[model samples]
Target: MFRRLRSPGTARALTWAAALVLIAGIVAFVTVRLGQEDKGPANVGSVPTGFASEDFDPNATITEPKESDVPQAARVAAGEFVLAAVGRENLPKAWKLADPGLKRDCACTYKEWLTGNIPVQYFPTKGLRGASFSVDEVTPGHVVLQVLLTPAASSSLKPTAFYIGLKQRGKDAPWLVDYWAPVDVIAVPASPQG
Candidate 1:
């Protein structure tokens, strides 16, 4: 400390060395940041508890075939029609066919449906394909139909079955969906904690 650098060039060289070290540190920080991995969006099926949205529109414009306008064959085959709509990815159509009580039971709104809250009890994200419908039980005004969903692949596995209940007001009244409970329940994924 006692003997300072006598030459001006020596002092300038020392300052340049300090500056170079600072610049190297900045470059190394940027390189590390750029090399880090990036995580994509969150999983599709889950929503956090107490999650509220002012923009949630429960009344989505879902068109349904009028009972009077529908043909006799289509009117009788409620399970088949709903399964067909779901298979085609016509969510709006299938939504219209669901019982209002089912929606209430799930505590789901149209906005939730838009975000993948399906009406079915259990929905397999993969292996959804062919579906068949059969009448399970028939009563005076109530009928239960079984819908067997066959995966596009997975021939070795047995087809999954979902039961839907329908009711008619009177002898000549049109059938309306009254019950839709999934035999298999899909669990909601937990929200991540910060």
Candidate 2:
């Protein structure tokens, strides 16, 4: 005859062990999930500590201010402002330098003027340099400036030119750029006889 089974103590111990194991597993899973959330996504690039935002613009062109040959103060200011704007790649500043009438005449907003209107060659970021900024012509309330865009040492491309026209209401009024255009250079073909 077999004795009746009566090991309640053993049964209780087994139950406790199972419960502890489950609790440990749950704790481990919660800790892991919380750690992952703290870390955010792995694919996101981490920015280096102590980064300066001023150095963010890689295309910025640095130039030293030299005495301008432009005689009129307004013309000189216009030329310098334009050069600085293009070199610094600050389209907003360039837009602010434009007269309100000029904006209307161009039928463009500041962003549109920057993204669609201005030529890449006029940007100093294109390594354009060796320029001669001059007041080519002057009228009562308007002035024209010639910018000779020569390739810098890093560039071997052909030189281009631009004329920027500035206007002001009067001599005492602030000068603003009203128009700008690239001067066309006709490329001559090589002779067949040669």
Which regions of candidate 2 are displaced past 4 Å?
1-72, 84-88, 114-121, 125-127, 185-194
User: Candidate 2 on 62-102: residue-level lDDT in tens?
Assistant: 23223353336665656565564545456677776777776
Error of 1 at 104 (Å): 2.2
Residues 84-187 of candidate 1: C-alpha lDDT, one tens digit per residue? 33343445655566556655765877767544455554333245577666555554555666667776575344566666777665777656666665556534
Question: For candidate 2, what's the RMSD?
Answer: 24.6
The TM-scores of all predictions, comma-separated, are 0.43, 0.48
Best TM-score goes to which candidate?
Answer: 2
User: Can you give the lDDT of residue 139 in candidate 2?
Assistant: 45
lDDT of each: 0.53, 0.59
Clashes of each: 1, 0
RMSD of each: 20.3, 24.6
Model 1 earns a TM-score of 0.43
Model 1 weakest 10-residue run by lDDT? 39-48
lDDT of 2: 0.59
